[model samples]
Target chain A: MKGLIVKDLLLIKENWKQLLIFVLIFIVIGLEGNQILTFVPVFLSLMVLLSTFSYDDYNKWNSYAVTLPNGRKNIVRAKYIASICLSAFAILFTYLLITISGMMNHHLNLEETAVTLLGCWSAVVLLQSFMYPLIFKVGLEKGRIFLFVFFIGVSALLGLVFQNIKISLPVEVISFLNHYLVIILPFVMIILLYISYKISEKIVQKKEF
Target chain B: MNAIEIKGLVKKYDDKFQLGKLDLTIPKGVIVGLIGENGAGKTTLLKAILNIIHIDSGTIKINGEDNKKEEKKENIGVVLDNMFFPEILTAKDIELAMRGMFKKWDTQVYYNYLKEFELPLDKPIKALSKGMRKKLEIITALSHHPDILILDEATSGLDPVVRNEILDIFLNFIQDENHTIILSTHITSDLEHVADKIVFIDQGKIVLDQDRDELIDHYGILKCDPSQMEQVKKEDYLCYKKNKYDVEFLVADRDKTRKKYPNSVVDKVTLEELMLLMIKGVK
Candidate 1:
C-alpha cells in the first residue's frame, strides 16, 4: 500500500502544477454553480479523485502497474484512499477559508458548518462511487461525454417542471443528510469500487498486450 | 533444476489464433531462443508464463512455483515492447519508484547500466532515442537480478552494435547457471550465435523444438533438379521446396540424404533458411 501511494505521489508531484490549476478551475466553477458554491470544494475534490483513473488511462500504465509487485487490488484501494483524502483536504481547506471570512464578517457557527460539510462530502462520495466504475469499465473520454449529456439533458428538461414546483434557494441539497442510506451508500461504493478493480484486473489479465 | 516448466499449455482466442498444447522445459542454466514469425504466439506464451494472461487449460511452473502464484513475480524479469514507462519520467524517477518494489534491486548495478549504456539519468524518457528507451527498460529489468529473464522482441529495434553489447551482458549473466533467459524474436541469426535451444513456433504451436547445434547438424539444405525432387521419397525427408529452376529440401538426416543423392548438392542450413522453408511450406 505504501508502495502504491509513493507511485501516485511521484506522478502527482511530476504533474502537480497542471493538476492544481485543473482543480482550481473546478473549485471556481463550483463556486459559481447554482448553489452559491458552499459545496464547491466537494465537487473540486471529487473531480480530482475521479480524474485519477483518467490519468492512469492516458497510457497503458494501468496494465504496466498491474505487472508490478503491488498488483491490482492495492492499485484500486490506493486510488480510493487518495481521492477520499484529497476530498477531505479540500473540504478542510474550504472550511478554514470560509471560517476566516465569516469571522471577519462576524457570522460564524461551528456545529452547523461541520454538519453541512459532512453532507456535501457524502454526496461527492456517492457521485464518485457511482461514476468511477463506469469510467474504469469504459474510459474517461467517452464516459465524461456520456455523463455531461445525460445529466445536462435531464436537468435542462427538469428546469421547466421544477420552476412550477418553486423553491426558496435552489433546493438545499446539504439538508439531505437525514437519510440512513447516505451512511450505507459510501461503504457500498467503496466495496463496489473494490469489486470493479478486481473485474478490471481480470479483464486486463486476459488481454494479450 | 528446470527454470521454467510449461505443460499442456493451450490458449485460444475467439476466431483469431490458438496456442496449442505446448509442452516445454527450460533447465536452470541455458539461454533459450523462442523463434517464430509474426503473430506466432511468442508474446502470448511470454504473457502466459508471467500469468499476465490466463491459459485456457494448462499449467506453467517457474522456479518450482506455480506461475499463477503472485509470488512467482519475484523471480521473473520480463521486458515486453508494450511495458511502457511514462515518457515524462526520468531514470532517476524510475529508480525512486522501484527502490522498495524489488527485493533484489541493485542500485549500483542499475547505475552501472546507465553509465555503460550512456543514458542521461535526468532526461525525460520521451526525450531519449528509441534505442535509449530500450536500454532503459533493459537496465531496469536487469537491476532486479531476477532468476528468469523473459524478453519479447526486446532487442529487435536496436542497432547491431548495441544489441551485441546487451547480448554480451546477457551471456555474462547466464554464466551464473542460476540465471536463465528466454528471448523471443524473428531475428534468428542472433539465436544461431548464442541460443542453446531453439524453439520454433508457427501460428501458435511449437513446430520444431531442438538444441541449436543439434538442429544445425540434423538438417541440411539439398539443392537438386525438379526431377530429382520427384525421385526423393517424401517419407525420407521432413520438408522440401521446389521452384521452376531447382528444388530445395530440408532433410532430417544429412548423411542419409547425402548418401541417397550422391550428385545432389548439400548446403549447411542456417536458422533463417530453416525458418523460411518451414513457414513457406517448401512450395
Candidate 2:
C-alpha cells in the first residue's frame, strides 16, 4: 500500500505546476467571494484525485498493478487513501483562507462560517463516496461523465428548491434538523465512504487486466 | 518442487477462443520457454498464472502454494509486452515505489542493473525509447530476487544486440539453482540460445512439452514421398504435413525413425520448425 501511495504521489508531483496555477486562480477568485474559497479546495482535491486516475489509465498502470505484491485490492484502497489525503489538504487550505479572510474582514460571522465549513466537508465526502464506486465500475472516463451528470442534476434540483419552494420551514424544525445534521452527517458519510470502498474493491477484484 | 503448476486450467475469451483443460508443470532451476503464435493463449496462460485475469475454472500453484495468495506473489516477477510504469515517473521514482512494494527488493542491485542497462535515472519513462523502457522493466523485475520470473514477449521489439544482452541477463538470473523463468515468446531463436525446457501451445492446447536438448537432439523432420509416408507408423510421428510433391513428418524419435526408414531423408528439427509444424500440421 505504501508503494502504491508513493507512486500516486509521484504522479501528482509531475503536475505540480498545473496544480499551483489552479490554486493561485482559486485564491484570487476566493478573495472576491468567501463561498468560492470554501468550496474550491474540495473541487481541486477531487480534480487532483481524478488526475491520478488519468495517468493510471493512460499507461494502463492498473493492469501492471495487479501483478505487484499489493495486488488490486490495495490498489483500490490506495486511491481512496490518496483521495482522503487530498481532501484533508483541501479542507486545511479552506480553513486557513477563511481564517485569514475573517481576520482581514470583520464582517465575517463565526457561527455561519462554522456551518458552511461543515457543509463543505460533507460535500467533499459525499462526492468521493459517489464518484469512487462509479470509477471502479466503469473506469475514470465513463465515471467522469456520470459525475458531471450528477453534479448538473444536483445543481438543477437546488435551483428548483430555491426558485419554486417559497414556504419556509418552522424555526423549531429548522433548528432541530440543523443540530442533528451537525452531529449525524459526518457519521453517515463515514459509513457511506466505507461501504463505497468495499464496493470499489469488489468491482476491481472482478475486473480483468 | 516445480516453480509453477496448473491443473485443468480453463479460460474462455469467447465461443471462438478458449484455453481448455490445460495442464503444465514448470520445474524450478530452469528456464521454460513458452512458444506460441499470436492468439495462441501464451499471454492468457501467463496472465492466468499471475492472477492478473480471473480464471474461469482452474487451479494454479506457484512454488507448491496456491498462486492467488499474496505471499506467493512476492516470489514472482513479471514483465508484460506493454510497459506499465507511469510515463511521468523517472526511473528513480520507480525505485522508490518498488522498494516499498517488494520485501526482497535490492536497491544496490537495482542501481547496478540501471548502470549496466544504461538507463538514465532522471529521464521520465515516456521519454525513453522502446528498447530502453524494456530494459528498465527487466531491471525492476530482476532487482527483487524473485524465485520465479514470468515474461510475456519481453524481448519482442528489441534489436538483436539488445535481445542478446537481455538473454545474457536471463542466463545470469538462472545461475542460482533455485531461480526459474517462464519466458513467452514467438522468437524461437532466443529460446534456443538459453531455454532449458520448451512448452508449445496452439489455440489454447499444449502441443508439446519437452526438454530443450531432447527436442533438438531427438525430434526430426522426415521428408519422403507419399509411399514412404505410408511406411512410417502413424504413432511414431507427432504430426505431418503433405505438400504436392512430398510429405513432411514430425517424428519425436529421430534415430528410431531413421532406422525404420533408411531410404527416407531425415533432417534435424529446429525450434521454429517444431512450432510451425505443430501449428500448421493436422493432428
Candidate 3:
C-alpha cells in the first residue's frame, strides 16, 4: 500500500504545475470574498486524484500493479487512502487561505465557515461513494460519463425536493430537518463510503487484466 | 519442486477461442521458451500462471504454493508485451516505487542495470525509445531477484542487436540455479540460442513440449515422394504433410528414422519448422 501511495504521489507530482495553478485560482477567488468557492480547492483535489485513474488507464498500470506483491487489494485501498489524504491537504490549504482572507476583509463568519466546509466534505464523500464503485465496475472512461450523469440527476432531484419543500412544507418542519442534516449527513456518508470501498474490492477482485 | 506447475488450466473467451484444459510444468533453473503464432494462447497461458486472469477451472502453483495467493507472486517477475509504466515517471521514480513494493528490491542492482543499459535515469519514460523502455522493464523485473521471470513477447519490437543483448541478460539471469525464465515469443531463433526447453501452443493447445537439444537434434523432417513415404512405416512419424511433389513427415527420433529410411531424405528440424509443421500439418 505504501508503494501504491508513493506511485500516486509521484503521478500527482508530475502535474504539480497545474495543481499550483488551481491553488492560485482558489486564493484569488477567496480574496474576492466568495466563501462558497472555498470548496473548489477540495473539489479540484478530488478531480486530480481521479485523474490518476486516467493515467493508469493510458499506461496500463493496473496490469503491472497486479504483478507486484500485495497488489490487487492494496491498489484499491491505496486509491481510497490517497483520496482522503489529498482531501485533507486541500481542506487545510483552503482553510488557511480563507481564514487569512477573512481576517483581512473582516467579513468571515467562523460558524458558517465550519458548517459549509463540513457540508462540502460530506458531499465529496458521497460523490466518491458513487464514483469509485462505478469506476471499479466499468473503468475510468465510462465511469466518468456515468458520474457526470449521476451528478446531473442528483442536482435535479435536489432542486425538485427544495421546490416541493418551499411550496408545501411549513417553516418549522423544514428548519428541523435542515438543523439535523448537517450532523447526520457526515455519519451517513462515512457508512456509504465504507460500503463503496468494499464493493470496489469485490469488483476489482473479479477483474482480469 | 517445479518453479511453476499448471494443471487443467482452462480460460474461455467466447465461442471461437478458448484455452482448453492444459497442463504444464516449468522446472527451476532453466529457460523455457513458449513458442506460438499470433493469437495462439501464449499470453493467456502466461497470464494464467501469474493469476492475472481468472481461470475457469484449474490450479496453478508457483513454487508449490497456490498462485492465487498474493504472497506467491512475490517470487515471480513479469514483463508483458505492452509497457506498463506511466509516461510521466522517470526511471528513478520507478526505483523509488519498486523499493516500497518489493521487500527484496535492490536499489543498487536497479541503478546498475540502468547504467549498464544506458537508460537515462532522469528522463521520463515517454522520452525513451521503444528499446530503452524494454530495457527498463527488464531491469525492473530482474532487480528484485525474483525466482521465476515470465516474459510475454518482451523482445518482439526490438532490433536484433538489442534483442541479443537482452537475451544475454536472460542467459545471465538463469545462471543462479534457483532462477528460471518463461520466454514467450514467435522469435524461434532467439530461443535456439538460449532456451533450454521449448513449449509450443497453437489454437489454445500444447502441440509440443521438449528439450531444446532433443527437439533440434532428435526430431527430423523426412522429405520423400509418395512411394518412398509408403516404404516408411506410418507409426514411425508423429504427423505428416503431403503436397503434389513430395511428402514431409515429422519424426520424433531422427537417428532411428534415418537408419530405418536409408534411402529417404531425413533432415534435422529447426524450432520454426517444427512449430509450422505442428500447427499447419495434419495430425
Candidate 4:
C-alpha cells in the first residue's frame, strides 16, 4: 500500500503545476468571474486524471500491476485511493482559495464558505461515482466518448427547453434542493462508489491482457 | 521438490489458440526454452504461469507452493515485451519504486546491469529507445535476484550483438546451479546454446520436450536422395520433409541408425532445424 501511494505521489509531483492552475482557475470562478464556470476546474481535473489513465492504458501497465508482488485488489484500491485523494485535494484547495479571497474582500464568513466548498466536492464525487465506473467497465476512451456525447446532448436539451418556455423554479423546490442535497447526494454516491469497486474487480478478473 | 510444476493447465481463447492440459516439471538449476510458432501459446503459457492470463482449469506450483500465493512472487522475476513502468518515471525513480516494492531489491546490482546494458539511469523510460526500455526492465527484474526467471519474447527485438551479450549474462546466472529460466523466443538459436531443455509447443500442446544434448545426439538430420526417402523407417523419425530432389528427416538417434545405415548422411541436429522441421512437417 505504501509503495502504491509513493507511485501516485510521484505522479502528483509531476503534475503539481497543473493542479495549482486548477486551484487558481476555480478561485477566479468563485471570487470574481462567472460562477457558472466553477464546475470547469473539477471537470478539468478529470482531464488530468483521464490523461493519466490514458498513459496507463497505452503502456499496458494494468497488466503489469497484477504481475507485481502487489495483489489485484491493491492495484484497484490504489487507483480508487488516488482518485479519492485527488478529489479531496481539489476540495481543500478550492475551499481555501475561496476563503482567502473572501477575507481579502472583507465579506468572509465561515459557514457559507464551507457550504459552497462542500457543495463543489459533493457534486464532483457524485459525477465521478457515475463516470468512473463507466470508464472502468468500458475503458477510458470509449467511456469518455459516450459520457461526452451524453453530457452535451442533455445540456443542449435543457437549454432548448429553457429558451422555449419560461417556468421559473418555485421557492419550495429551491429550498428543498438546498436542504436535501447534503443528505441525498452523498448517500447515493457512496452506494455507487461501492458498486464501482465490485464492477472493477469483475473487469480486472476477466481482462485478458 | 521441483522448482516449478504444472498439471492439466488448460487455457483456450476461442478458435485462436488452446494450451490443453500441459504437464511440465522444471526442476531447480536449468534453463528451459519454450519454442513454438506464432500464437502457439509460448507467451500464453508464460502469462498463465505468471497468472497474467486467466486459466480455464489446472494447477501451477512454484517452489512447491501455489504460484497464486502473494508471497510466491518473491522468488519469481518476469520480463515481457510490454512496458511495466509508468511513462513519466526515470530509471532513478524506478530504483526508488523497486526498493519499496521488492523486499530483496539490490540497488548495486541494479545499477551494474544498467552499466552493463549501457542503459541511462536518468532518462525517462518513455524517452528511451525500445531496447533501452527492455534493458531497464531486465535490470529491475534481476535486481531482486529471483530464483526463477521467466522471459517471453524478451530477446526478439534486440540486435544480434546485444542479444549475444545478454545471453552471456544468462549463462552466468545459471552457473549458480540453483537459478532457473523459462525463455520463450522464436529465434531458436537464442536459447539453442544455453537452454538445458527444449519444449516445443504447437497449437497449445507439448509436441516435444527433451534434454538438449540428449535430443541433439538422438535427433539426427538425415539428408538423402528423394527416391531413398521411402526406405527410412517412418516410425523412427519424429517428422520429415521432402523436396523434388532431396529428403531430410529428423531421426531421434544418430548412433542407433549409424550402426544400421553407415552410408546414410547422418548429421547433428540443431534446435532451429528441429523447430522448422516440426512446424513445416513433411511436405
The best candidate by TM-score is: 3
What is the TM-score (0 to 1) of candidate 2? 0.93
Better of 2 and 3 by lDDT: 3
The residue ranges of model 1 lying beyond 4 angstroms of the native Cα positions read A20-52, A103-107, A110-112, A142-209
TM-score of chain B of 4: 0.95
Candidates 1 and 3: which is better by TM-score? 3
RMSD of each: 4.5, 2.6, 2.2, 3.5
Residue pairs with backbone atoms closer than 3 Å in model 3 (clashes): none
Taking the true A–B contacts (Cα pairs closer than 8 Å), what share appears in each candidate?
0.31, 0.75, 0.75, 0.53
Q: Which stretches of candidate 4 lie over 4 Å from their true place?
A: A12-41, A149-180
Instruction: Quote the lDDT for B82 in model 2.
Output: 80
DockQ-sorted candidate list, best first: 3, 2, 4, 1
- What are the chain B TM-scores of all models? 0.96, 0.95, 0.96, 0.95
User: Candidate 3, residue B145: CA error in Å?
Assistant: 1.5
Candidate 1: residue B136 Cα off by (Å): 0.8
User: Candidate 3 chain B — worst ten consecutive residues by lDDT sum?
Assistant: B226-235
Q: Write the per-residue lDDT of candidate 2 for residues B1-283, one digit (tens) a residue.
A: 8888899999998799998688999988999999999999999999999998889998999999987886568888889878488898999999999988889999999999999888999999989998899989988998888989999999897899999989999999999999999999999999999999999998899988999999999999999998777787888898998879998899988999999889999999999988888888866
Clashing pairs in 2: none
| Model 1 score (lDDT) | 0.76
For model 4 chain B, give the 10-residue run with minimal summed lDDT.
B130-139
lDDT of 3 at A159: 99
